[model samples]
Target: MKRKHQILTIPNLMSLFRLCLIPLIVWLYHKKEMYGLAAFTLVVSGITDVADGIVARRFNMVSNFGKAFDPVADKLTQFAMLVCLAVRFHWILVPMCLILVKEILTGILKMAVIRKTGIVEGADWHGKVTTVLLYITIFLHLAWYEIPDVWSIALTALCTAMMLISFILYGIRNLKLLKNRKY
Candidate 1:
């Protein structure tokens, strides 16, 4: 099973576009005070995220680079949104920090696993659900300026809890993989 490293594939291009949207979204949300455009950018990024995966699997255009690049783009976009929102909603910082920590630890574990076993443990159902919840939470914050402060805080806390659960599950899976490795 020779994995390709092609860079010109459709999915890779879509992932790159999603990465490009991060800065634009930040500028719109923070500098220009264009919440509508910012929210739209996020929606587009999310659409592309799903589209890339479908195209990759449907067209058999999956590559090692795509496998890695797609998730990096997704995380960066999510982190950018969190940072932008945290400027206004301080509670967002909690989930932002948790996500940062989770990404750092899981990223290291993932690389170690790939080096040892040549297997990339992609996003599980829990991780995907966490991502969806994060997106929904962000959208609620962005789209509804009238949302009560308490509600926003509660949603952010819920997102944080789900993220923590995802982090724990990934950690357990990685530890199991490490334990099974033959020294």
Candidate 2:
């Protein structure tokens, strides 16, 4: 059975499209004063994120490229959103930096593991939960203008804590894999 490694699969396409939306989202948020439209675009990007995963799994269109590209798109979008919001809410930089460091470390670990074991680890529950919480937090900041500043700060801090926990969990899991290596 030949596996499709093509870059133009449905899921890959959707992921690419999601990447494309980031600049538009940023522009809408910053230049156009279109918070509502920017938020809608973000929601659409999230939908595409979920849809791509489901379509890839259901249709057996998963590839190594998809495995890699999907998360890149996700992280890029999340980072962009946080940065954009940080312009308004400076405290958001805390979580933004945390998540960015976590991603960089995890990405390095993933590359090492794949080089040694050829295993590409998928998203764990903790990571998924963190991502969802991040999206919700961003959405709230974008849409709920009535939310108090204190509440927004609290939410971002909570998300940052979760992001740290997820990073630690992933580190533990990957470290164990490395320890078990038969070298």
Candidate 3:
């Protein structure tokens, strides 16, 4: 059994810090009319989210609690930011819906795989790239103060493509792993 202290290590604590920043970001975006600053905050939080995983892995601190909490933290930040943006920008629904569906379905599949295989691969490389692209797209969209011209649209399209492709890749990888399992 894992020790209780391990569950609250520095990397996991950083993940939790990201979670705590979500509400402030949303509030700044909505109430304070500070989309750019909010977007910046989100970008910082995203970096921390990614960093936590690296820290956990580099230090061999991986644990069930961290595994479970990391994805939840990521999805919470994604959902919160997307939902907030969706409320103001209806056009965001397409990508937001795709993200939400992918997250929810994959989450369920991951749990089943864990139950059966007694292991999960965590987030793959494609998944990490997709997340970075999503963040870039979101930042571009939220840069309302001085919206970039054609590049924003291009990045949005690129982000959507990456997201869909990543979803497909993750599904295929996980399905293959599941199929190969003896249990």
Candidate 4:
């Protein structure tokens, strides 16, 4: 059990900042010329995300609110960036829809696991890898709007595959947790 959690911690504030960047990212994505600005803003958001985690752990400022809120911020940012990219890259929808299903099923399973195990499960390593791949794909598309068609498709496929893998792994873990729950 960790201590020193409070609502006003720096990590929570960083998560809040990331959440607030969504609209700007979306708007900039649409403007075309502002893609650079959008990419820069997204980079800042990503940096803040990494910093928040480091700050949270290093400072022992991890709060329940932050543990919940950080993932929400990450998901929203990814979703927003994907939707913005989907307009230009139709293949982006594959991961977007896959993530939609993944999140929904995982959300339900997470709740059941928590009820059975009485613990809020943190994200696993596969989930973190998927997140990184998703961000990389998004940034590539944004930063290199004219990226060769083949590369775009390849990256999208890779991101989708990673998400699918993580989805299955998370499902299995959650089910096992439910099965092994102490009654």
Give Cα-based local distance difference scores for all models. Answer: 0.88, 0.89, 0.78, 0.88
lDDT string for model 2 (48-140, tens) is 999998998999888877888998998999999999999889999999998889999999988888788877677889989998999999988
RMSD of 2: 1.9
Candidate 4 lDDT over 113-154, as tens digits, reads 777787677788999999899888899898898988899999
Instruction: Single out the weakest 10-residue window by summed lDDT for candidate 2.
Output: 1-10
lDDT of 2 at 154: 92
TM-score of 1: 0.94
Q: Model 4, poorest ten-residue lDDT window?
A: 1-10
lDDT of 1 at 160: 94
Clashing pairs in 1: none
Residue 39 in candidate 2, Cα distance off native in Å: 0.2
Model 4 pairs in collision = none
How many clashing pairs in candidate 2?
0
